[model samples]
Target chain A: DPVTGVFRGVIAGCGYFSRHHLEAWRRIEGVEITATCDSDPARARAAGLAAYTSADQMLEKERPHFLDLVTRPETHLELIRTAASRGVAVICQKPLAPVWGEAVEILRIARSAGIRLMAHENWRWQPWYREAARLIRQGAIGQPHAYCLRMRHHEGRGDDPFPAQPYFRDMPRFLVYEILIHHLDTARFLFGEIETVCAELARLNPAMRGEDRAVITVRHQSGLTGVIDGHTLHPSASGVALGDAWFEGGNGRLALDPNGNLWTERGCVWRNDVAAGYRGDSVRAAQAHFIECLRSGAPFETDIEEYLRSMAAMEACYLSAERKAIVSPLKFLVDSQSE
Target chain B: DPVTGVFRGVIAGCGYFSRHHLEAWRRIEGVEITATCDSDPARARAAGLAAYTSADQMLEKERPHFLDLVTRPETHLELIRTAASRGVAVICQKPLAPVWGEAVEILRIARSAGIRLMAHENWRWQPWYREAARLIRQGAIGQPHAYCLRMRHHEGRGDDPFPAQPYFRDMPRFLVYEILIHHLDTARFLFGEIETVCAELARLNPAMRGEDRAVITVRHQSGLTGVIDGHTLHPSASGVALGDAWFEGGNGRLALDPNGNLWTERGCVWRNDVAAGYRGDSVRAAQAHFIECLRSGAPFETDIEEYLRSMAAMEACYLSAERKAIVSPLKFLVDSQSE
Candidate 1:
């Protein structure tokens, strides 16, 4: 047994997040996925673990130490609450909830139960992001007055119905909350608490109910203002043809020099270097960090508190989008608390 | 005599526009600068021609055949109308007038007088932009379902007050009218007439009065949408660097692909390539084309009517920004006509 006594786990959602977690856990020593549960029985069985139809059955039978909540955002609150009640630490994917109130409740419940909660805000752990943070700390870009972070690609409509989940489809503002929060968390992790947020949201791609595009401006507590523009709807060259899908799919570039000067230039060119690890495989490294934190009670680099603050920023972005005005995080958090 | 008889010309203003025009006209075979007029007498003489205290004196004495109006937006209407009444074929730099009504009046007077009124919308003549247009037309990027155009650089502020004019200090929407019009024209030139425009304007740099940044979404007649982001506030970098200053600074990379792709990569990795004839010295080629058109009495590649339509679309962008609602260019133009 490891120091935390073997953390037997079950992945209850077998989607993209689940695939990443399952693969990472398999590589970590002393961690065992004793069972797997999914709505799709076939997918659950294919994982080579004892298959279960539901999370309740898996929790009741396996008595796992941890439950990796890779399910949809709507299912997240219930899963975390259940895990807390059963004294099972929860490692859930963001958004913590579809709405802010639900996210707060999940955090509150986990706190009362004294069970650890980790939101998989993995962009903070991505190699380039980590390098950016390191360079900024080293003063590479000279006090870092402004940053323009963008994640856009020409994504063809996938046959999978996962992206069109009800909680996702109906909420136009949640696209910023669900998708761009990774970049937001990345901003916070590199800079600090955001002071004010002003944003504009639009649904360019009519197929999705949510805003497929957003341009958000954030003023950090350090007086640094950063703009994040995200779109999953832009047209891009195919990854397979480029042989470097991660770097070449989108027309943007972010680099951190050895002297800590962080530079980002977009709308010029796209070149992918496979060897540099620009791909979105940093989730595996993030999973490893979570496991280490779970075993040693060492605070994770991106903890629940940090994720909650990022959530606060996300909620502020939605409010700014709603009111069509600039919103301060402090005022937003206070108002939400009153509500 | 270069076929079109020698024309005594008075350059109405002395700034960046005047500098470029003087350089181009000096090289032309037919025209000669008889007098120079500017609000500032010091600059008038320094601009390499006989100084005139005012346009009235310059026009009365020199009786110039052509007037190049490169003054501020507020003074454009008066300068253009005065020049047109004298049957002087006018070449004016853009934001032809501060307001659309004024612009229409200027256009009307020029047409009534049977004088040529060229907007000097030089972006259409920019080699790189023209090359991008050609490639898209040639199906290099395969129909270009979407385009992301960005124009940003770091040098809008400087210690020298002369470079930053007085009108420039308070012009509330320079990006939309001046800079973005270039990209907007490029989009329309490459794509087609924009049907609807949705935009978000922000004053990211507090030092600048006008919104220094804007993200505009244009829905073209062809069902293709384009996102054009313009900023005069981004810190100086190699890729999006502006003008002769960038070439002088020497901070970017220029390479040649044996296959005729003239590649320039900035931010260390983003590569953009255009076919050989369309690369570096293509600005001179564009100028040469303009001169050839003038000599042959042939229509210029970028027609004034087409440029006016692009200006109409740009006006829609400002309306969308102010109204905080999607503005339709086709509707706006029709409504203006009806009114």
Candidate 2:
């Protein structure tokens, strides 16, 4: 039986991932959306939760078990720090902060205060990716030497309102931190830790201030090299709609489908041996694991300390892209972790 | 009727394009293959022409009108310079030399000797590219914003020998010069000259010295931007195996197919309203144009002087890849041209 607690929290944003998070929380037993906050009053009220003008007001009125900070990256550190100070455990998004220094600071504060902090790095919990990881561990793909992950979309303009935020639009490290972070973390999750990164960032469209395209090469600690290419400007009809992982090893090539199927090549023939499905219920599974850890005092699978290193890796990529030189994640992390 | 004693030449290497160049030379009437040379002694003797151990022997004994230096890039400059000094007006292959300095010196020597040099930049002669150029000129694609050309091969091992030497294996730039030169030249041919270039080159297999993958973006003198991506590493069963070109204007979008087909989209619908095919036969057509220019004393369509700038652009790409920074082709060319 699940532990019973009064699960009252404030959702500080209503955007792309916010809807999914809100819906997931609603489905979880004993969880209640006590309050919601957004700059747009209409969107905040439309969520059907008790709408509040600000996070401070909501926290004062309804003290909650967890603060689900789904706002833009710029607001993440401040909210998490405030939540930690106010004695609320925090569940922040994939990129803990817009910058690496702030991400470290957030983690440091949470660690010192002994408050639980979970970075919503859902890619590791992604069903397809998890299955690929399992197959890789099972030696289905031999010793992986090289991997490629690509996520591309042609349409840049969208009806989605989240990207309209001033920070999202103005951030120079948009592609590196926003989208590629998931893939970078996924690379770390599958191939141990990234040791070095060399990357190129381009703003293909003149109308956009931030980069819409990136091609990054990561060298892992396990001697596996990988390239992750992300282009938000690619055409939608190009059949490669989702990112895929292609692993080349001594035995043969194993291509992990976007839907979690495994295609292996042996001798001269290729076969899709795995069923086309997710490994399991990813979001609920991760949420359940987090909740279990929170209740039983078991160690969290993806702790804030581990995620801070990934954030440092992303910062190295940004510096590499800007400086046009290879950046060592280890060096960056050493300095970042020192403080 | 064409003038007599203009020049005579021999097809030194015979392969796919050798036959085409032979056919074109035969049609020109004045030119003659006094001899032919192929390292494969069997094919050389079978052609019923006096065969020689080397190009120098062919030049000394046969004294042909010109040397159709159809061999690989490594032999291009030496063969052209030898023929030009012997008073042979030479028509060399695209990518006149393996590297920029060699190409520059070849042009310098050819100019001093009063010998005409023409690079077989044949994409300009392809009817479809010609039509695309016409449409762009006619404002059909408006002021061409960003263009993408993807040239790919499903499967080809490194063992396949062509013409003389295994050009692809020795020079990493062969893939850049032999294949991508067409697209780069076409982009410049249609969109005007390139000003600055930034590129990333990858060799997927370390055993293969040549780069099998490349993603290059150029900023043109016309204030238009473009991207070119090519790889020999794509899956064998991938569909169509061609490239795409996107031209964005104030009005709508115009796209081009790998085989030179054209499509225009305005508001709602897309219309495929262009011809289709390899468009490679334009090599012969372009050669024909060069022959006509020689006969009429008209300026060649692809002037060697003008093409030297494009060669500089190619060199800039190499420098950028090596130095990992943006390079200005014009700045690199200034010293060479002045010298």
CAPRI-style quality class for the chain A–B interface of candidate 1: incorrect
Model 1 has an lDDT value of: 0.64
Pairs with steric clashes in candidate 2? A154-A234, B8-B65, B8-B66
Q: What are the per-residue Cα lDDT tens digits for candidate 1 across B1-339? A: 246566557888886557667766766666687778888999898876789768877887888766777788789888877887777766677777787777767767777887766666666665555555554565544433444565554545333212445455467777688778877776777677887776667665555677666767666776565567665544443242232100000122222222223343332222334333322333334445555555566765544454567778888878876665557776646754675
Candidate 2, overall lDDT? Answer: 0.68
lDDT of 2 by residue, A1-339 (tens): 245564666788887667767766766666677888887888788788899768877777878877788888888887787788888877777768866778778878898888998887766777666767887897776666556776654454343312545355556667778878878888888889887776667665554567766767676777566677666554333232254567654444577654445577543223334332222345555665566667777776678888876777788878876775667788767887676
Report, to 2 decimal places, the DockQ of model 1. Answer: 0.10
TM-score of each: 0.73, 0.74
For B254-305, candidate 2 gives per-residue lDDT tens digits of 6665544567754322333423322445756777777777777887767777
Q: Model 1, A188-283: lDDT tens per residue?
A: 887888887766676655566777666676667765555676655433332321111011001223453322233544421223232322244566
